[model samples]
Target: MAEQPTRAWYATLRHLWLDERDARRAVPPALAERLRERVAASERRHSGQLRICVEGGLPPSYLWRHLRWRVPMPKLVHQRALMLFSRLHVWDTEHNNGVLIYLLLAERRIELVADRAVARRVDAQAWSALVRDLGEALHHGRFEQGLLQAVDGVTELLAPHFRPADDGPRPNELPDEPVLR
Candidate 1:
């Protein structure tokens, strides 16, 4: 006789496989507000537009599925972030220095996608380090602090390449608030 899937396996799958729209509920309002404020402040410091997105779970689609329980469903956080990078228009910047900091709450996964302008100057290793550090904080439930640190890192990284002109104010090309999905 074949053995059945264990309770722990089902619990793990539930945590990572939930796709309800209410997935956004996992993020507390206070944390979202804090992240939004941080992004707003960070955007003011550099020419690059910075956005943080928190997603509860990825929607069911071919792009976001993983093999589990004799089925190929549920997407990885990084894959979803890549899709959002384009869908959210994070690339629509004058200098092409927009950045998306995406977080998957269910899996506690973090992915950072930088537009070509910024990616050329900042190495992937730098981004990996930021994501790794931020993931650690998020793993510990330091949602607010983790996001603030990530925003600060972006500000520091992009400050040199995307600084504002001294002559006149540059119009904010992107929205300052973080997006939740």
Candidate 2:
């Protein structure tokens, strides 16, 4: 597993900020200043760490069949997947003899940290489903979908309680279209 920063997320944030700035540029001087101030305030409030964890696993009966499917399967597999599918830098480390993926998109200040042991216990189908759902949610700017996916990926035995943080503006509250330049 590789952990890396997400470039798309940063691009999205920068694009949004630029759009807002452009929109305010056309307003009256006083109003433009107010708008800029409001945008700055909102940006300050929204900027923070967003952490997401997903559990992964294969059925116990399939353990033997998936012996080679363990986290950090092979360097080639990691490189190939990261090269083709990943948009961020992925860092890997050992924990409890299992792999842990730590990805930080510092520009967006978003971190995705997950334990491989949790992933190893869950079936691939279920894990894939969670990832797909979460990915779609993220692409559509729906953080709640990401949260739900994370909650659902956990096993009953190791499920952790997560209280949603009231950090920034919800997706719905953000403008659907970027403020035109």
Candidate 3:
């Protein structure tokens, strides 16, 4: 694996200043509800699960690792996404096609984590391009639009490999609501 790029000191301070309130403000209740509905609708088209997690800042442990080990912020953020993927049980779906769309508000960074089956089909470059486009929208404060596009992007990626048969709804292995932390 490649080494994570280290962030500057100011970035650490910025992360320390944010909390759950910042996350809530960025994605308020109404928008979150809309995103949840979007995820639900998107899931109906395929046999994949999507979990959205918007975190305001890195927890102390992540920060500690970054500060002490000079770990790159991107890697740390990706690690957090993977941790949530497992913790939220996104990996337990029957088809092994669950995906996590994780946004770190403090860093204005997005990470996508895919289950084994989905990862095998989608290349890393495709995910990178999707994240880059979503980050641009997010940097402009278009959180709702950015997240919607992200969910759609994941759906598009999964549909080719995991589309359901007979137009019937697939089992929802995970909750649709976007988690704010």
Candidate 4:
């Protein structure tokens, strides 16, 4: 396990406020809708479900409690993503082929969580590259481009394992809209 970094209170405040103040500029409503549509289209190609979420930062509750900040950023992001993965019912797919692409704009970090079916087929290294590439685009202020590119990547990766049904279309197990925090 990695050691948790304890950041100063001021550092935490800066990250929370600075990122929240500019979330609209980072991923405006128009771009968010576009990304949502991209996911919808991508899901049609594969039975697996794909969802994208962008959060401004850790909740204010964490800031209120000092010890929570002692938790590492990666760990916080992973924990929140996992919670949303279940809360949003990403694991409800018939084939366990659900994926969530979570971005913590405050930390400039990307986290991808997939259900069991996806884990069985895709390599962790491949997912790491996809996340790295998406994070790069975000760092460069290419929010829509980065998200769309990742959606395409997820579509390609799962299309082989969960092909479209021949008799009838597969249901949209999850919503395509981006969950903004």
RMSD value for candidate 3: 3.7
Q: Each model's TM-score?
A: 0.81, 0.28, 0.91, 0.87
Worst 10 residues of 3 by lDDT: 1-10
User: Which digits, one per residue and each the tens of the lDDT, describe model 1 over residues 2-92?
Assistant: 3333543453465557643433564567766777787777777778988877776655442223424333222355667888888888998
User: What is each predicted model's overall lDDT from 0 to 1?
Assistant: 0.75, 0.32, 0.88, 0.81
Q: lDDT, candidate 1, residue 82?
A: 82
Clash count per candidate: 2, 15, 1, 0
Instruction: Specify the highest-TM-score model's number.
Output: 3
- Candidate 1 C-alpha error for residue 46, in Å: 1.1
Tell me which residue pairs clash in candidate 4.
none
Stretches of candidate 1 exceeding 4 Å from the true structure: 1-26, 62-64, 68-75
Best by lDDT: 3
Q: Residue 145 of candidate 4: its Cα lDDT?
A: 88
How do the residues 1-181 of candidate 3 rate in per-residue lDDT, one tens digit apiece?
2333334566788898988899899888999999999999888888889999988899989988887888888899989999999999999999899999988988888899999999999998999988998999988978788999999999889888887757565557799998889
Tens-digit lDDT string for candidate 2 (61-164) = 32322233333223322333333223222222122111112111111112223334434544556555655665566567564445334333432212332222
Give the clash total for candidate 3: 1
The TM-score between candidate 1 and the true structure equals 0.81
Give per-residue CA lDDT, model 4, range 1-181, as digits (tens): 2333335465477566855446666778898889888988888787889988777777766544535536655677688789889988998888898999988777777899999989999999989999999988978877788889999999989998888788787667788888877
